[model samples]
Target chain A: MPEQPDQSEQPDQSEQPDQSEQPDQSEQPNAAVEPGPGHRFAPDTEWRRVSPKYLVVEVIGSIITTAIIVAALLVAFSLWGLWWTPWAAGAVALIAVVAIAFEPRRVRSIGYRLREDDLLFRRGIMFQRQVAVPYGRMQLVDITRGPVARALGLADLKFVTAAAATAVTVPGIPEAEADRLRDELVALAESRRAGL
Target chain B: MSGAAPAKPAVDLADGEWHRLHPASPLLRGGLVFIAIAGFVIANLRERVVEFFLVIFAPGQLDDGFGEWSDENDWGRDPIGGIVANNLVGWALLAVLLVVVLVIVGFWLSWRMHTFRVTPEAVEVRSGILFRSHRSARLDRIQGINITRPVFARLFGAAKLEVQVAGQSGNMQLSYLGSSLTDGLRRDILRLASGARATTQSPAPAVALPSVAAGETLAEPLPGLAQPAGPAAAPGTGPATIGSRAGAIVGQRVDEFLAPELDPELAPPESVVHIPVGRIVGSTLLGGAALWMLALAGIVIVGVVSRQLWMLFTFVPAAIGIVSYFWSRITKSLRYSIAGTPDGVRVGYGLLSTANHTLPPGRIHAVEATQWVFWRPFGWWSVRINVAGQSVTSGAEAAQRTLVLPVGTAGDVQRVIALLLPEAAEGGPVAAQIGSGLTGRAGLDGDRFSITPKRGAWLHPFSWRRIGWAASDGIALLRRGSLVRRLVLVPLARMQSVALSAGPLRRGLGLAELRLHTVTGPVVPTLPIIEREAGDALFTHLAGEAVERANDDRSQHWGREAADA
Candidate 1:
């Protein structure tokens, strides 16, 4: 675990709660692994992370996409003897390698927190998006599983609001956890149903 | 037909009686197809027609040269021409006549079958001869009512009434109703939808039942109104001679085309805000036209520098496109006016082909007041809205339909906002707040709005001082942009969700961006580069407030007695 002395450097504002006073559960060895070196905004709020096995799922997806692109280029080269096909194939392979290397860190960055009235979801490293979807505004709580994810006993939980722009997807949760979360969210949405 | 007299009693259109549309509806709807077919037929059979006329006028001059020329040219390839060349002209003419008759009969039959009925509970329409379909919109779910008079339909004095409901494919259209009756009909429908009883002696029955006898008299007035010439050329009338009557009809049509688009009965004459024609033209020139001109100048400069004179030819099409676009914008916003009525806010625009729509209370989800950089000197602002059941596609028609105020001053924007969201504009503070949002620098009015910190200037170099958000009585105001100033107002109850995002740079600066999700439209409420702690607090506050307000919101049944109370 990283050193805890960094919290002391933050300036104290009277209006803001002292995040250093709360125990940092994320640093615990048994807790879900945290990704990246970015500072958490509301450290007091407990955020649940997705399973580490999701890195394998992401790596597999990237590999399949890279293979398809390379195969297409090879087929074109065989047919027309194009000069740039080999270079394009190599560039694509290099990108796929870099993406696969960062898969573990990307998976660790995904987290969601269930607040009193809404679900706060956070994802991404370079560009972090943290959205709070009110339980009352949720029109749908859906669970979807891909073939590879299903084999690995994982699923993705999605929340849909009336506005098409509020697309929130929490991917790579264990199947049992996903189903339970879906049920809980559906019940909350029902109890606090709000019209558009 | 004495009941069809011009002085007939006011018809209660919402009495649950089935009424047929105007007689000219079929002609207006199918006229384009008929014209295309006629043009095709004429183009194909032009030579045969000329030949027939020649044979009649100059039989003695007919020579074998014509036949030899026709054979050498091999011109009888088209089916119509081939039939005539084969000496089957009479049969072909007969066939064309039959087809025309069949089409007329079909149109007449369809017109007879198409009917609509308005009851207190719902407005229903039934149409189609072969594949009959019925659609109904409940009074409580009505979003708005729009009356559109296309240029051709306007000449025939007919308009289309569309009852907008809050779902995709939920709107019901009653096309080609007599223009004179559409306003009254729309008023009656709105009254019924507002949960108000009809103003007649007998209240409509609670249960909807078709009263055919009452509808029988309703059909008489349509033809009388559709064809004004019928009464003008009444038999044995002394003052109204045939020649004079034709002149009167022409004069009346001219007056209709040139008349100002306003209904004094629906909106008070003084309340309507008219956008001056000069302002419309000026704004158009200052807008996209100026951009096009700049682009042309850039091309000319490049052409001169590169010594490629042929590059100048590219300006021809671009110039034509810009001119046409500018002209279309001017024509579309010629007589734009907006006012508040008892039912809701009424907006009307267009010169020759007018369109008027009434948006009832609480139907507007969000509103945006925007000012382009060029329009800033004139203090001109345009207002757009996010309304349910209205098409949000990007086009001239869609843009005009969604825009409540095409161009207006700060006062006009305030008045429109007051009309659209009375709750937000309450106590007159919204005016000052909006004024600040439009032009106020951040640090000067720091107390009025929660603005982006000075440290976040790197993210928005020129606009950091302008980006801010403020919340008032149940509305959130988001202001941003320096060149094109924008202020988006979203009611708390209408917020779909709230989000906070931080990029790598923002994260290092301890700042986050807040976005209030609303229905898809031109307005995207986002306030970027604010303190992270403030972002969290605002997110929590908005999420809770939205749910609380949504629970208390009774805007759906805005016209109901409970909501009014």
Candidate 2:
């Protein structure tokens, strides 16, 4: 676990969200297109910055894994005539380096968007996935920050649904945005409460 | 608290149910972590010479210890086998290590796989770090939430949630959620479920049977309802402590007799319907006697084959048989009570496996009761319900829900019918089907016979004799039969799936049997509409177009109170 200060310590950190900081999709002209009858703009916006600590965690994990493999292989080679030990060690070391180098980029790419009725999260490199959690079925939203995420001024927002096993996670999102989204979900959930 | 003035007071179904973190989620994580660590430990120790010998050469390695240990405690191996085993020890350790890693990784993934978000409207199932999959179940569509905290999970405080759906096997679930989240999800979904009927139109008024509240409804206590101010029962007056000396004695003795293993009773305090100790002891003794006899016979066989005059040799099988018997009996030791009120019914069974399953009057597909030939003399009939989306087995030591009434006569069955399902007992599709089938002596005759055929009908006066099934004779044409002469019924409501079955042989004869799936029983884990599944499926398909078309069957009035048993 990262031993670092959480985002709540930020001097400018805001909890009570102002509506002025609305989604800016200025890059897409089609975004302005009106909803015909049943259609609504996809509820969420594009990705935003993720917690910076994710980079360090990913790199460290990959490096430790690499070191273990290299040490084991060297021992095996010396003792049990392990074949191609040097080459395997080299290949694994190269992977660890690549993973470490790209860690920062992957961390930056993690972000979530809030749509009118669904929440979407976008992550991954070559194969990016977009998840949508519908509003009507929304149960509760929790904003949690692990030690590493806490150091990076980021939080993970989770959307829980009633289905026994479906929870969507928007990980490494900006703490401020995470709180705003949590508020929005709570408001909408309360508003949608069935009539007494 | 008056019923009338509160015009739709609470969000009916919405208000009653709640969700909290499954209490054991963290324990589950810890368990997973332990298993992973255990794997690592195994990996670390796997390559060592002495441990390697322990694994393969040791008798304890085999699941049943046949290849590993000598029956005569002669564990020595040939000189060549020992040396070869030593030479390959390093490779074996490496392989075991690799296996351990894979197992650890798989468990972590599985733990990750079962993560969930439960709400009032629906439950969400999500898994996979790379190639993720997600499934959600609407509250109304969910028959019941079957939860099983496996032995490992129990240690970790984690449990799996499986929802039994209408006309489906294993609808969906989440795993290893902390208890709080699981409870929260259940509550939220049940809340949303309570709102389901309201969604189609206006919500139906939820009937909260007062008696069913704690047990049947699985009351969430509004988060602030403290424990009953004081134990109303005097300090010494509690019926019997489950883990107490007596309970443990009962648990252990039952375990030795082929009973289902006794996990402690898990249903919330309210749902506990206690049975007298005498009944438990009596049934167990009877079952245990039968098993002991079987073990004796096995010993005789073993002795005859070996020609050895050994008293100690027979001990193993006899002990094993006793253990197996205890496990079976403990698992299926049947005891239950139906807490009924005007609103609904809460059926709790098995002191240890007590699960209080409540069905709103609206969600019931059907109810059925049948008596095996042995039960006829004593009038012991078992009742089952066709619940839409009801859970079959959730891995909770007990099954989700089955209302086995107190062993009663036909008259008592009638009263229970009146209390639990007044309309069905008075004559709905359930009552009519049961009534007509019982008195009508109707059956479809084909070229086959049942397990207890009409010929064995009188063999033992106390046995559950087959009623009127004669494969060749057309006299009981009202009923239906094939090789499996099972009877069934389907309410127009809980009809989600329907199909027809005709085996290769049956197809040649140009005959088809309609199979209707109902929610009931852990055995085969289903309720099939033996004779009418096909026709029902086809008609229901069109009825589904309108959705509300079949619900009209609820009002179908028929007088079935006196329908033949």
Candidate 3:
């Protein structure tokens, strides 16, 4: 009989994946942790939110989208002949410009603090909600980056749980910060388990 | 996936595409759509067209005369008007042709714009016609990957691949690849993301595990239930070993009866749901409705035959019925084929279009069973799995065809749960302590402490049914409310990362909730169950030690003897 690669047999094998300083190992570095109040994030650590070139990308994308809509309208009118309306495109463009200008900061205002024991994620500047997941309850600490995240030199940290909402997300931070946070969280989670 | 091939990992299987039925599909369909629009437009414009033509004929703004001409006939006008209307049709035809050409071009452009690429590290999706939108996610970030094969796509050999990575995904994307490629890609992606070896070291593959004793051929429905072979096994949670032939027949029956129903929204022909007569009225109604519709259809056929010599294909009703019968036959043949080993489980279903899924223990997120009123007489039930990253919800096409059943029989539920999530599957001695309503000490094992508010009595109302909760590094316990039951299984390792918080009302009540989070595997799922303070404390103490070794880097090289380590 072939061995099934017993992860539980050597509980340690399940602990190995989380090592990465710059090695973008696919996702956030998640490590198991013991359950306790001690798993909170370090109080002093502050998340220096990345400027979100990606946010700007989204806005620029909207602009490009508006432009395309306008160009499409022009071609469409050239063929269909606009009888009842003429300023429709202008009105839409104006509305889009307004929504794009100030929506980004409020859009990506996610904050994270890697305290000694827990991971604190505060997001939505206006409707700011502080979510503190202890390192022990922290099921898996993951670091993920996409093409946009990569371009902005940022990464997303996800805190998964068994609760109905298994995933808590913190986005738009420097890749280095994401790495440190992931490692620290994983290590903390591991330590909690070790105490058990 | 474990032994199919070495260099190449298993990929997701894609749903196929059907020949176009949508207005925007094939050239013929597009043309028909345009014709319909044109016909409606021409029908409404007839009167205006006649007036416009009369204007061309009279020239000197004979408004009243033109109106009079319009009143006489909608589309026809004296000579000049006729010419203009004909010219208008000509222009409209040409314009429609131009539009048809543009639509085709647009479709091709969009397909290209939404192209996606998969690499070892990340999956990149680039979309947009004008503004460039590029999306990429690390392989590990992909929380779950759902692969579906719809019947239409099956016909076309083009399946849609829906990759659900954590963080907001814009929308489900249709992967360009079909069956083989989709499967290959899914396999490789999961292998890389899960941190499992993409290329297995073994030259020989592992033998397929059976749900029964060794030497059993996998050809049919599992025979009778496996005798409760051991004492520790939970009551009713016995192994059901199926023989190869029995397994095949049962599987075929499920494919025939249940597969079609998988897409519940699809109205089978005659609006009839044929079920065994002895079953509930829900099943009986199906039969009566079918017979009644058949009689009515026959009458209509007789009437149609009387109209001009017999038109063959005009029997659309009969055609639909034929197809519906095939669909029903296929459903009766389908059954959920499941086999459980300590390592993992293999679940298979469907007939011609089959889906086989495998998930090892420790990867399952949550499992639940549900029963509808209609199922009362049928003795049937449906099960659901919430694997952290995977959402069984499929696209419109494939959702109709995918297998929701991982295993049949309620008995397999707990064991399957054990196969997927080991922590929650076990029962502990703490039942007595909690039963006595241990005010401040909710858990019996002394692993954790939780206060028993009036809510504690509701924890295990009926023998073991609740939302299971597991602390990250604490004691795992089960909990339930008059309205809800949450069973938590806290591994000592999970207790290390604990957090406590309270909202406005909860704070007033001196009640705070603690959250435990951790993630792993292709499933890389996490669990955080809420408890009134002391319950949280007890779990913390019980499960804390397991987290310690999990943190040590030295233990990391313990299991990779066959791989890189």
Query: What local lDDT score does residue A142 receive in model 1, on the 0 to 100 scale?
Result: 89
TM-score of chain B of each: 0.86, 0.48, 0.48
What lDDT score is found at residue B155 in candidate 1? 87
Best by lDDT: 1
Ranking by TM-score: 1, 3, 2
Candidate 3 Cα outliers beyond 4 Å, as residue runs: A1-116, A119-132, A135-196, B1-86, B112-114, B170-172, B196-410, B422-477, B481-533, B542-565
How far in Å is the alpha carbon of B510 misplaced in model 2? Answer: 18
Better of 1 and 3 by DockQ: 1
Query: How displaced is residue B348 in candidate 2, in Å?
Result: 4.2
- Candidate 2 lDDT at B22 equals 44
Candidate 3 DockQ, CA atoms: 0.10
lDDT of 1 by residue, B73-183 (tens): 465454543553566767866997998899999999999999999876799999999999988898767888999989998888788998988775688889989776777
Report the lDDT of model 1 for residue B444: 81
Docking class of 1: acceptable
Cα displacement (angstroms), candidate 1, residue B326, comes to 1.2
Q: Write the per-residue lDDT of candidate 3 for residues A54-157, one digit (tens) a residue.
A: 57546766788889887877777788988523477777788888878766765566556554345556555433344555565565777888666677787777
